[model samples]
Target: MNFIRRLRVPRLNDKGKWVVCVTGGVLTCGFAYALEHTADASDFVVHPFQLPWSHGGLIDSLDMASVRRGYEVYKQVCAACHSMQYIRYRHFVNNFMSEDEAKAEAAESEVDFIDDKGVPAKRPGLLNDFLPSPYPNKKAAEAANNGAEPPDLSLMGWARDDGDNYVFHLLTGYGFDPPEGVLCEEGKAYNPYFPNGSVLAMPQQLFDEGIEYKDGTPATMSQQAKDVVTYLRWACEQWHDKRKQYAIKVYFGNFQFRTPPSFFLTQIMKKWSDFSFFLNYTLLPHGIQSVKKDYLF
Candidate 1:
């Protein structure tokens, strides 16, 4: 019943296999040829350190509890300056909060719209209402932050390079004094992990005991940073795990998709006598050349 079952890839012949092999070789060569000869990072900037994220693996899913905690952190802390223009209050339903909680959350916020008289009016937020911005306009945002506007956070995660890792480090990287030869303006602070190690206008936002958690999790600086990063990751891709689940279902549907050595591999019943088509190159065979369980087990 799956769409992948309906996918009808023509049985490949020798000529077709050669074309695929040659095209793959050409693409591989072109990719290697385009490699940049550059340093690991910009001068004065520290490379983002990889953190062990619970949702980072290919098969792993988001930590909903962390996401809930992260929303709390953002509401109490980052929401003061930044705006999540793309996220709606109703997005929380069945994601981390229940429908009732989402409705309650929306009810707490007021939305601006035009009234029947064509006058501006305020109303309680709905599920479709976008999260409110901290400032009325870009100019106001910049003015309040000393001419630097806070960026919208809806696409912050999964949008930047090393997105989640970079954010986690930046939040906890503050409070360290500048190294030798570093200069900061009167109101700026240095964070080696961001802005190319430049002095930025934003100050340390997370601190120990800054806020209490509803779940009674410790309110440490690192804990807050990790939770917020996890939350932002979910905000970036709510259907991330759903996509993985779809792929898994494809293999379980239709006829037997595997051989002795291959798990979930769709092969042409023939063996070394004919070519085998797989994700790319064939790694296992069903006949004499069939791979051992190491290829499946």
Candidate 2:
């Protein structure tokens, strides 16, 4: 008991130092952990009355005609203010449309000239050129609008978890009452999804009066909203298709090698057959399987 007590007591130089250090470290860690947990929880909490449809998955299938019409709306109304700098004219022609059609469209939208150095300046297409900035740059735009610059729409469809629907809602959802004393800015209206119950900086820009459609479709506000939403959804599905195709190819390439080593190939085949049956019975109801063939050829 004497020896144990001697060991338990700290030496004169070390008394209370180790205990203080350990207690401080534990408290600091607990505070840090709590802060991290609070931030994570805040990220997941949906704003009041933000609908699920605002995220993508409302439309059942791709509508090519609607996407084309949406492109027309984007060119006529949105292109002046926003730019899709990353995409090239060649990409549209080679991937989405015929070369001749793309060239004609490009020629209609672009102008060529000579530079001061007498070098030929080829403006092949508006799609190939960056949109001229409304302000000198991002900093100027921010200064003009209380630090809110209009975001690029090109990848907006793919950036958010439910990007397509969120955009659709934003375009249509404007002018709602806020609580007393919570004043909205000029041309801005209350939106539940925005950080505060305030409003977005960009005013509602799309309406039937804004553009004339040659297709004889009603140029209603809802129609324009639906068209732009379709365009964004098409962009999303275009990338999605590439990924799905790659996955199918990889699965097929590895299919033959998954067989077990044995003289009885019958047993190996039987196991695979059972797996297929199980998959069809279980996964088919959930709509998880994308491929039609049970076995890869």
Candidate 3:
């Protein structure tokens, strides 16, 4: 009778073990299914690209003429509200124009500073003086704008994925919506490219009669947008050159057979041919297949 009881107890324990295993398996499968479905759903949702130079977008090449026009607009109109602090008077002479032109332009503006020799010198250019801060700081600027401070225009061109186009649209795209409940603040307006579909700070700042251009280009909204975009682009290009030079050098040196001696030309050609074949046959198709399956799953 004791032996029978022990056998019955063992059977009971085995059944319990089986039950626990089944339950754990079911829970694990359910969790995995939920996670997979969530991941799949995310692929359908499009997130806006945030980088300055996102892939697969149209970008205009740098145009010196447009940039010159932009400098004029910035000097005449935007200079009052915005400041290009990172740029220097010497930069204009070195990078954009002749020294004589730079000097003449500098003479037209007022900038005073103390020299290293403890002597006060007044430079006749905007670059000599730091553009006065629009507000004490970010907090103050935000307070003035009803909690939305206008961003600095220094790198504004490269801050968005569509760079120049984004600047252009932001400058020109201002209007009202018919749904009267739209909460556009007193000085704010609507912009389509912006995620909020409304901007809180900038109203139509540019108009045909707002400023006079020496080039006789009509001071239309489009022209102003183009000018400002060009200026911002130039600023970004300047910054990018400083930061990306090393990476660019490495890329060209490694890939273009620029590093190896002349005797290795044949070997380099062979290596390139092998790499091309591998890329075309194995890598490219495999990548396409993986991407397709990932989306499908």
Q: Which structure among the candidates has the greatest lDDT?
A: 1
List, residue by residue over 39-64, the lDDT tens digit for candidate 3: 75443223333333321133324555
Preferred candidate (lDDT higher): 1 or 3: 1
Which model is ahead, 1 or 2, in terms of TM-score?
1
- Each prediction's whole-model lDDT (CA): 0.84, 0.64, 0.64
Backbone clashes in model 3, listed as residue pairs: 106-124
Q: Order the numbered candidates by TM-score, best leading.
A: 1, 2, 3
lDDT of 2 by residue, 1-297 (tens): 888777865554465778888899999999999999777545522433344332233323455667767777877877756666555555555444578866667666545569889997856555455433345578876776656877667687777666666676667766556656556777565654555344567666787667877677887887887787777666545655456567777776667565444436888789989978877887777886664354443
Backbone clashes in each candidate structure, one number apiece? 0, 0, 1
Best by TM-score: 1
Off by over 4 Å in 3: 1-61, 111-147, 178-181, 239-297
1 versus 2: better lDDT goes to:
1
TM-score of each: 0.72, 0.59, 0.56
